[model samples]
Target: MTKGNLAIVLHAHLPYVRSEEPGSLEEDWFFQALVECYLPLLETLEEASTAKDQTPKITIGLSPTLLSLLEDQVLKNRFEEWVSIRLELLNKLETNCTAAALDLKGHLKRQLKSWKSCKGDLIGRFKKLQTLEIIDILTCAATHGYLPLLRENPEAVRAQLKTAVREHQRLFTNAPLGIWLPECAYYEGLDDLMSESGLRYAVLDGHGLLNADPRPRYGLYAPICTRRGVAFFGRDSESTLPVWSARDGYPGNPNYREFHRDLGWDLSIENLKKIGIKEKRPLGIKLFKISSQNTSLEDKQEYDPQAAKESVEKDAESYLKDRKKQLIKLEKSMKIEPLLIAPFDAELFGHWWFEGPKFLSHLFIKAKREGVKLITLKDALQLTPQIQLCNPSPSSWGQGGFHNYWLDKSNAWIVHEWSKAGREMVSICSGGLIEESNIKIIKQAGRELLLSQSSDWSFILKAETTTELARERINLHLKRFWILINAIKDNKNITEKIIDEIEKEDCIFPLISPIDWKKKI
Candidate 1:
C-alpha cells in the first residue's frame, strides 16, 4: 500500500437546462463551462499524458444528467453553431482591426486563437483521458438526489442509484466503481443501496465519519468500510479549506483575473440586447480592457498574461507547502500515512475563477515533484480496506455542517411536497397494478419524483446564488412530478404522450429504464 494518499475529486453537475428552439443563451452555461473548465482540464491532462513525472491521476464525478446532456445531438449541434460564431468573430477581430491598436488586437487575437484551437473534438479529449488512464471518471445520481431525506422509501433511493448505474454504463461502457452522493448527503445504513448498486466506495463530509456512532479511529484521514462491504472516504477538511476559502485561498490573490466585474453586463446591455438590426455583441474578448471595480471602462489598462502566470506559481507553492505540512502531521500521528481527500465543484476551476485551470496545472506539476500521490477513492480503498466498521451520521458539506442548507425553513416546503408525492407514488406502484404497461407508467412517475427531489436545485434557488434560473429549474421538474402523479392517480392512459413530451423538452438520462426502477425491492 502507498504510504500517504492525496486524491482530488471534482463533482461536475448542473440541472437539466435545455431549449428545443435553436440559438438559445440559456444553453450557454453548459457551453461556457465546456470552453472554460471541461475542455481546458482535458487539454491539460492530455498535455501531461506523455510526461512520466506528470502522473495526474484525477477522479471526477459527472452526474448522470450531465452525461446525458453531453451526448445530446441537439446540444452538440448547438455547441457547434456557437463555436462557429466565435470563430467568425475571431476572424473579424484579426482582419478588421487597424494597425494603430495592434497590441490590443494582438491580445484579442491570441485569446480567440486559443478558443478556436480547442473547438471540435472536445469530447474526444475526455474519452482519450479515460483511454489513457489519466482519469477515473465516476457517475452520480440521475439528478443528484439528497438520498438521506428520501428515506421515506428506501426503494426510491435504490431507484436513483440504479438509474445512475445504468446511465454510467450507457456512457462509458462500464459501471462506475465509486458513487458520488449528491451534496455528500448521507445517512447511516445508506450503505445497503450503494452496495446493491455495486459501488466500491464513496465520499462523505468530514464530520459524517468523525461523528459516527463509534468514532472513526483514523478520523478524516482514512477510509471506513461498512458491513455492506462498501467503503467510505471522509473528506479532509484541513486540506480542502486551502483551496476553497475566499479570505485566505489562492482565488483572493490580487494578480489573478477578476471574476466579479464582467464586460458582459458593464458594457451597454442595450446594444447586446438587440438582435437582427444591430452589430454583433463582442464576446468579451474585446477592444475593452479588464479593470477592477471603481475604475471606469475608459480608464482601464491592458491585461498582463505574465503577471497572471507568476501569481499561479506563487499560489502553487503555497498550496504545496500546506499539503506537505498536513501529510507530515498525519504521518507522525496516525502511524499509517493518511490520505488527504480534496473535493470541489468542477465549476470552481474556470467558471468562477478564470485563472483556476492554470492554478490547477501548476499545482499538479508541483505536487508531482513534491511527492503528492493523486489516487482515486477506489484505488485507496483497494490498497487499504478499513478494519474498523463505521457508519457515518447524516450530514452535508453545507452551512451548520448538516442538512440545514438544503432543508431550512425556506426550502423545507420542497422536501415536504416531494416526500408526500414519493410516498403516494410508491404505495400506488406497490399496490398491484392490472396491466404490465400500467406498472411501467407507475415506475416512470417514480423516476420523475426522484428527479424532482434533488436538494441541490432548491438550495441553489434559496441561496440566491443563481436565483432566477434555479427557481425556474425547480418549478419545471416539480410540474413534471405533478403531471405524472395526477395522470397515474386519474388512471389516464396517455403514457406515450406524457413520455414523449418529457423526452422532447428535457431529454437528459434517456436510459430511464422504468423496469430498473420498478424492480421489487
Candidate 2:
C-alpha cells in the first residue's frame, strides 16, 4: 500500500521583459530561461509521460505575463536566432573546455530539436501534457502584483485576479482552478477575491498554514480550507530543504555546473560584441564545476558530465528514500494519508541547477520503482476532500516570512505609488466614460497600472541587483499610467500614434477588463 503522496510544484515566472532590441539584457533574461529551463523542462515532462507505468504527476504555475511572452511570435523568432548564434559561437570556442563545450552543444541541439518538433508552441505542448494528466497548470496574477500590498484597494487586487483568470482561460481553453499567489503571499480576506475569480485553491509558505487562526491538526502534511471556500497547501520544508537549500542542497554538489563562472565573463569584449553583446554579462555558456565550496571562480574545475549524471542518480535515490521514510513515520502518527508538498521556482531546474531536469527524470524513475506516490496538488485535494477549515495567517515566502522584504527601506516608496495609481484607476474605471477614445485610454491605462504594480521591480530594488533597471521600469509604467489617466480626465485628444506605441511596447493581457476595477458595493 502507498504510504502517502508527494506534490512537486514548479512556479514559472518572469517579469514582462520584452524589448525592441535583440540581445538586450532584459531580452537575454527571457531567452536564457527558455533555452536553459523551459525547453528542457518540457522535454523532461514529455519523456516522463511516455513511461509505461506510473507517469509523473506535477503542478506547474505559469504566470500570465510569462504566457504572453511564450505566445509572442516576434520573441519566438528572436529566440531561434539567439540559439543559432550560440551554436555558431560554440563551434569556434577553442579552449581546454572542449568537453564542457561539446556537452552544452549536445544539450542545446536536443533542445533546439524539441523546439522545432513542437514548432515553438510550448504552451500547446504543456496543455497537451495537462490533458494527458501528466501535469496540472496553475495561473498566477496578471503581472504578479503583490496582493497583500494591493489590499488597500480591493478592486486593484480583483483586476489582478480577474485579468489572470481570463488570460489563462483564453490560452489554455479552461479556467485555472488554482493560483500560485505572487510570492506565496496572503492577507486577510484574499481568499474571497480568489473565490470570486473562480480559483478553488492556492499554495502558501508553511507558516501561512501552520499558524492559521486555529492551527491545523495535521500541520503541513495536509491542505487546509479557508472559510471563503478556497483550499491552501502549505510548503513542506522537509521535502524542499534538500532541493532548495544552497548549503545543504543537491544543486551545490561539486560535480554540478557552476552558475557564476560563464564564458561571457571570460571572453574578450571584441568576441562578445560579435554576438551582439554590448557589455560584459553572462552569455549562459558555463563550463565550470563547484570543485570545492571554498574554491575561487578561477580555480573551479571543468564540469564532468559523467560524474554529474552519477550524482543525479545518487541524489534522486536518496531523496526518494528520505521521502519514503518520512511518510512511513508520518503514517503511524496521522489517521489520514500524509501529503508532502514541494514547491520551487521552475527556473531552478536547468537554469540555476544545470542538471536539475536530469535529477527530476531520475526522481520519477526512482519514485515508480520505490512505490512512492508522486502526485499533483489537484490529485492531493481529490484524495482528501474533507479538509480542515482554518483562516491562514497573513504571510509571504520572502525574508522574515512577512511583508518586510517588499516593504523595506529600499522599496517602501513604491507602495504609495501603487496605491495612488490604483485609487485613480478605480475612479476612472468606475466613472462610466462611454466615449470610444476615453474607453481606449482607460484600457491602456489599466495595462500600465497593472504593469507598474508588478512585484518584480520592488523585489529588484530590495535585492540591489539591477536596481537602476528596476527603478526605470517602475517609473516608466507609472509615467505612462498618469499620462493616459490625464488624457481621459482632461478630455485631451491623445494621438492614436502615441497610444499605438505604448500598446506595442507593453502589449499583454489583451482581455483585461477595466470593469474589474469598478468598486463593488
Candidate 3:
C-alpha cells in the first residue's frame, strides 16, 4: 500500500447560535459560510471521490457545535429559503440585464446554477463524500473546548472528551479516530484523556513540536506519539501562512472577491429599501464588484464569476509549487518522506476567501496529476509507530501562543469569573459528588458545567470580532451551570426549569454524565 504522505486537516467550527428569532441577523454569518465554504467544499470532495486518476483522502474536523448547527431543523429550513433568495436575485438580475450587461448576466446564471445544485444542503453532500471515501471526518470537543485550562481537574477534561466522542459516534455512526483540539490548544498529558476516550490522534500548534521536551525527531513534517500512544501532528507554518496570513495570503488577491465590500452594507439605501412585497426587510440584493484597489462604488465594475474561477485555478497551482518546495526541504533533513500538515479553519475557505473552495478542488486535481500526494492525517500517523514518550507543555495557537489570549489584561474579567465558577463547582461536587446512587440530576449539571467552561468562547470574545455573541454563549452555558450546580448544592430536585432552559438554549452534546466524569479524577 503506497501512502502519498501529505495530509490536510480542515477544522470547521462556529460558536452556538441558537437564536430565539426566526430570522436572526447574526444567522446570516453562518448561512453565508455554508453557501460559500461548506457546501462548495462538499461538492469538491464529492467530485474528487470518483475521479479516475486520483481519489483524494482528506481529513476534516467538524466540531460538535458545528454538527448541531448542521442538524438543526430550523436552521436547515431557513438555509433552503436563504438559497432560494439568492436564486431569485439571480433571476431578477438576468431579466433586468441590458445588452451592455450580457457578460455579467451570464456570470450570474452560472453562479445561480451552482447554488441551485447545492441548495445550501450540505449534510447530505458531506455524507455522500464520506461514503465515497474521499474524506475522513473527525470530531472535536463538544463546544470546541480549550482543554488545557481545564487540566487542573482530570474529570473536567475527561467529561469534555467523553461527551464529544459519543456525540461524534451518534452523528457519523462511527467512532471518531482523530480529534481536533480547539485552536490546537494542547498540553503534555491531554493525550491521556483523548486516548481514554478512544481517540487515536490529535493536532497541536507548530510550536508544540518545536518545543517538545525531548524535541520531535521528525519536526513539523511528521507526527509524534505520546507515552500513552496517541499521535500528535504539529502544524506546519510554511504551508499554513500563505492561506492564513491576511497581510500575505491569497485572500488578499487583487482579482478575487472582496469580503469587506459586501453589497449588504455597501449598497445605496434607496436601492435596498424594499426587496419584495412579503419581505419588510431589505436583503441587499444589488450586485457589484471591485473594479480596482480603492475604487468607490461609482467606479466599481460588474462582478465576473468566470474570471474569478480562472484565478482560483492559477492560485491553486502557485500553492502546490510552494508545497513541493516545502516537501523537498523536509525529505532532505529527515531522509524520510515527512508529511506536511496544513490545518486551517474551514470557514476561511468560502466565507473569507470566496474562491477558496475552487482553489482547494483545483489543488487536489493539480497535486494528484503532478504526483504530489494528499493523504489523510490518520494514515500518516500510523506510518511510524515508534515514538518517544514525552509530554508537551501547555500552549495554544492564539496570539501569544499561550493562555494569555483568554486570561490576559484584555480578557482578564472573563477568566476571573470562569475560574471562580469552575473551582466552586468542583468544590461543591467533590464533597457529595455522585454520592446518590441514582443522582441523574447531578450528572446532567456536570455536563453543562464542563461545556460552559470551554475556553474557546472566552478567547473569541476577547478578540472582539463577535464579542456580544460570544458573551451570550458563555453566559448561557454559565447560567445553566449555575442553575444545575445550585440544585445539587441545595439538595433540591432538578426541575424542568433546568432542562427546559438548557434545551431552549438548544445546546448540543447533552449526553455527558457527571458521575462518569468524576471517575477520571
| Winning model by TM-score | 2
Candidate 2's C-alpha runs over 4 A off are: none
Q: Which regions in candidate 1 have their CA more than 4 angstroms from the true location? A: 1-3, 23-25, 84-124, 275-302, 434-447, 465-468, 493-499, 515-521
Worst-scoring 10-residue span by lDDT in model 2: 431-440
Extract clashing residue pairs from model 2: none
* Model 3 RMSD vs true structure: 4.0
Using TM-score as the yardstick, the better of models 1 and 2 is 2
Ranking by TM-score: 2, 1, 3
After superposition, candidate 3 runs with Cα above 4 Å error: 1-4, 89-125, 267-301, 424-444, 454-456, 493-498, 519-521
Q: TM-score of each candidate? A: 0.87, 0.99, 0.86
Local distance difference test scores for all models: 0.70, 0.91, 0.69
Which candidate number would show the highest lDDT if scored against the true structure? 2
For all the candidates, what are their Cα RMSDs to the real structure?
4.1, 1.0, 4.0
Clashing pairs in 3: 188-392
Q: What lDDT does candidate 2 reach at residue 364?
A: 81
lDDT of 2 at 449: 93
Q: Give the C-alpha miss distance for residue 28 in model 1, angstroms.
A: 1.7
Error of 1 at 468 (Å): 4.2
